[model samples]
Target: MNSKKTSQTEHPPGRSSTPAAWGALAVMASLLAAWIFFESLACGALHAGLTCASWMRGDQLSVGKLTYEGNGIFRANDVEFVFGTTGHRSSWKSERMEIHPLHLVGMLIRGKYQSFRLIRELKVGKSKLLVDRRGAGDGDRGEASLPWSESFMNPANFFPSSIEGGPIDVVVIGDAYRLSLSGLKLLLPDRWAGKVAFDEAQLDMGTWHGTFSHGAAVAGWDGTSLRLENLNLGKETALHEVTLALRDGRADFGIRGTIGKALIRGDGAFGSPGDPNALELTLVGENLQLGPLAELLGQDRRASGTVGQARFTFRGEPDNPLEADSSLRLVANNFRWDGRGWDSLRLAATLTGRKLTVSELSLQQEENILTGKGLVNLTRDWHEALKSPFTAAFSATLDDAGALASLAGPQFATLSGGLAMEGEVRGAENKATGYANLQGVGMKIHGLPVDWMKGNLLFEGDHVVLSHLDAWCGQDNISMEGSVQNSQPHAYKASAQIDVHNLTKRLGQLGIKTATTIGAGAVKCSWQGEGTREAHSGSFQARVTEWISKWTATGMSGSFDGSYAPGQLRLTKAEFLQDELKLSLKLNASARTLEVTDINATRGEKEAPLVQGSIALPLDAMDVWESGDVLRTIDTSGPFAINLALRGIKAEEIEELLGQKVRLTGALEGTISANGSLENPEIHGGLKIGNFVSLAGEAPADLNLTIDAAHGEFKGSLSEAIGQTPLLQMELEAPLRVVKE
Candidate 1:
């Protein structure tokens, strides 16, 4: 009866009975409350569990807001996670983090996750990152997705080494990680970059990918090892593969790249970027183009060459970096630099903390070689280094000085002889002190012929001291000692002691006409001159010895004390000594004329006749320096005079001049005065012979003569006679004629 009645009480589909609907509604409501309660409890439990785990993990976890949604989903707003000790902690913040309950539970229960994802947009300092993990296999094999943008790639946020700029993807596969970029632009700081060493180096890649493997033993990365593949930097610079390894406070890297037309192979290692203990490093490059390298260094000049092999090594620690050990070597072909070039170059150098040593530095071309070496210091600033204190020793040997014509200028273009020099230098570059000894054979300087030359030179600042110089000047040996100063404009002081052998031959070689055929002499001179090259003035002193010219032998000893000031030169003392002749003169000169102030001459002893006079000589008369004439050119414009006094004379001496035997015994006394042009003389004087005798088949005769040169008349009378033809008289009148020899 009850079953029949329940079957008969069926309600329409759209409408239900009040009692049945009420009961169903109550059951649904209860289920909803239970779902809500479970969800809330799950969210709360998750929050509490993570908080407790954070404490155990030495992490500080904070959440701004926590909420739960349908289907076992939970979200946290403004979540923060801090790891590490308080003293050195790192923190990460997330705008929002989402968790799927079922997936989390599965990961926990399985112990090893096949797949799991924790999605968040995280930030560290000023950078933001999107991190996700797809799967984890016992914490060893995992697939992680870490995408970053420009705002998320900052060097300071990570390690001390620098990096910047990226829209990159970091992917994980098993125990390895990769960074992939379609177009990457990167800038790295110096001291840590692989191929380029600069304050900042830039690398542009159209597409690049890198991978690295890490171990659990390391806190951040197992070891500093980065492998790059498929890197296209630019048209001029590209690399197929590169590997960088940093371990044990050191870095090592290798690269195979292309720079312009040259294939580049490079390997290098150095200490940690900022390690306190000195920086020790070694770098080697093979087949590297210099042009592109110069461009990379921001230099204006372009170079063209390929370095066959180059090596650089550094050692030792420096407290101030000024005393660091460094060295460099280069082997290159067709090397060009600074508008000058060389065919092949090989250089090796070493720099200790205190000094620099150049073991080998040379340039080779066919049969010519130029070698050089020196010592110097290195400083942080080039200018400071150039001005710092230093001592250096250098030696150069050249097969042909013409090979260095570019450096020696056009004046030395014709230099074609072997040259060698050894020198030592001390002090700074601008004001240095040094000594150099140069030797040359069969050489010519500025068209001055030299058979063999040797010079010892010392220099200080702008002052040069030529201590000793001996050279063959046109088959003549000349030795000179002098000093020259160039500290001021046109202000020079020079002193020289010059000794010449075979002066006549040397002068002839110089196109000079000389009266002397053979001569040897020494001149000691000192001059202090100032002004332009065209004109100069100063004090001058000269001492001459053993000077013999023409048929006259004079200047066995001579002295000249003179001074040139302004436009005038004054000779206060000029004297010469001969066998029995002595001459002294004083003179003054200007641009117009030379005035002879005083002249005195003596023969034999002090009792001999003395002559003195003055002459004004035109400056043009002293053109010996220009005409190269050894003979004196004395053409005077003003009045000229000669005074002569004669005492006793021997007959044998008269015969010596006349070249004929004369029978004469007499004492001659006369005073002669002449004043006129040197070419023609006007004489007014008288001669008297006492006890004179002429042997012409006759007896002796006393003769008296009267001469009036202006009137061209002479009167002579023989007063005493011992034989026939005594008391003879003669008078003559004739035109004056003077002969010059």
Candidate 2:
């Protein structure tokens, strides 16, 4: 070195030495290292600060390295982040992440969040999450970075606590779930006790991905508990005064909230090794709607009703609900389900092991009120409780039994009554035994008014027995017994004893008017029927003695037997008797017509013919007779051949048959022949009366009457004479019309 100094051709100190050359190179390298260090520092610092100030006020993150890629571009790898109020740490590891830092400046002024298309591994709690690419949607999606390195160089950047941001995608995790948010927006409070509101973000799991909401909430953490004031859950629910304490793998929570317009409150504890569901919940509502509440429970209940209140308590394993201990008390008003509805309901029950005990149950529906208490066995699943083996007792009262018209078809529309009943049921699901006794007063069925009706029924499965049934309607009374066995296709038998006093009077009470009354007496009836669910057939018989009619003397008698089906009815036998008068009739009828198979009538001990032969009635005159309108026009389907032997006819009997009270005595003998259709009838009859006796004395006279109809004209002559002397004579004729009206 000393020799070099003297040489005068100096190269600067250490410029030629090997170590000096190294030193110069070191300085240049140092300068380059310093530049890189500052760049990284700026990038990291500005990132954390901007994140906390703009997106999440409490956000903190550590990035492996953020490198600048020119044109305001930046990249990062292996990012670890802590977001929102949760202190839980999550990490993102990837080869590279592209971003344009300066773009965030403009976005920061727009007050919106962007959707992120997550394509790689996102670890949340121990669950591996992958955001569905297609689900991310292409709208409002973008990514930008905070030019941290550039901002670090500018002192102005350090002073900005916050800057409004547009919808920009940033790699940030949700507090509860791992979600890829879209249009995310957050309004964080400056103070720890202030409120925060956010919405229009997407939801994946524990992540904040959802739609827009204007709900506001203030949350505070006091050591072990967190409470939220004024928090909205979804579009229809809001929570108030909610507190949750989570510690040692256990969470204790309480909540007061509203679902739609219904108020709800509950408290519970969950987690740990023992309890699957440990809670006590009470919901008290007045006229609360059921549709929205049902949606919250993931059920479709298209019904109308008000939920009065419900209390539920449970503690046990979820896998074996029968083995769990639970209690429930449900009360509802105007609750409806399955095309039926109830006025009000109250139920209380408790479960212990495999048994469920019902302490109280009361239900009011329509015009009926029912009460029951029972106990039943249950299997592992709670659903089996419905069809399980059990014993139960129930009682019911009907304020207006007719209001339950749907159960009995259209007949109830004309019926009105109330019933009181009590019953006991025992056995398994498919095979059961039950007994019930019912009594009703002021009952009516199909216009048949009854003073009272009482019956007792015993049933074993599908078999039913009507032990005894009694009906009393003023002067009419009936007693019956019946049984129905089997399922859909049932076999049934019934018998009844009826007593009638003053039948015409009873008919009037029922708003019925009949053209004629054949008889009124004790009637015995029985029938055996067998059919499927849709159709039925049965045979019935009625016998009566001592009959009377409005147009005849009091002494009368009759018997009637018939078979009936849905479409047809046949009178097997019908006999009528009034004094010495006797009549028999057999007929078959359909919906529109009646065909008389046989008909014969006679009078006196000699059985002289009064009328004979049958008539085919189309659109029969039965309605005319029922309405007491004898003059009503009628039509017949076929020609008729009939004979009337007017013999042994007394004047008193004739007067009675004609609905008169004339007092006279005589015998008349006649021969009458009739032919042709009812629309154009022909009749030729002759009658002679001798030994006629009046109230005063016997008349020495013989009366002769003749009737003839032919050629569209009718002629009749009446003549009376005393011995050979003529007392009176008369002749009458009338023109006939070919068409009947």
Q: What is the per-residue lDDT of model 1 for residues 1-741, given as tens digits with 9 covering 90 to 100?
A: 988877777643676578988999999998888776976777778789778655554456888887876555577778777653333344556565555444456545643523222311111122222222212212221212133422343211223232332322222221123222222233332233422111222322222322222101101111135555445554366665577776554667676767676666666665522243334556667787888776654454446677888877665442234455678898999776544566888889887765677878787656556666777766656556665566666665666666666444665666656677788877654456889988877776655567788889897775677788777755446666656654435344444444454444455555665544334465655544545445676677777777655323343567899988766879999987666656689888765566775666566777453445565644432354444342344454344565555465544334433334546766556666666654455666666666676665554455666666663433333345434555766667667654434
TM-score of 1: 0.42
Candidate 2, residues 1-741, lDDT tens digits: the string is 889777776555643568988888999998888687866766777576656554332334556767766655556665554432222323333444444443545544543442221111111111112222221212212323255632343323222221222232323342233444333232222124634444433444322234434456776643345677888767577888788776454668888888788887877775432344433333344445777766654455745577778777766543344666888888888766534567987899998877788988887887688788888887644455545777788887876666445334555556667778899877655356889898888877766778899999987776788899999987678888888764546667676776766655566567776556443445555555555567777787776665555665566667888888877788899887777777788977764566675666677566556556565555444564475443343445355555656556567676776567877777778777777766677888898888776656656578899999976789999998888899889999999755546
Report lDDT per candidate. Answer: 0.56, 0.62
- Global Cα RMSD, each model: 17.4, 12.8
Model 1: lDDT equals 0.56
Model 1 alpha-carbon drift over 4 Å, by segment: 1-254, 259-263, 267-274, 277-281, 287-306, 314-321, 333-343, 365-369, 372-394, 404-416, 423-436, 458-465, 475-478, 483-494, 497-741
Please report how far candidate 1 places residue 186 from its true position, in Å: 6.6
TM-score of model 2 vs. true structure: 0.55
Best lDDT goes to which candidate?
2
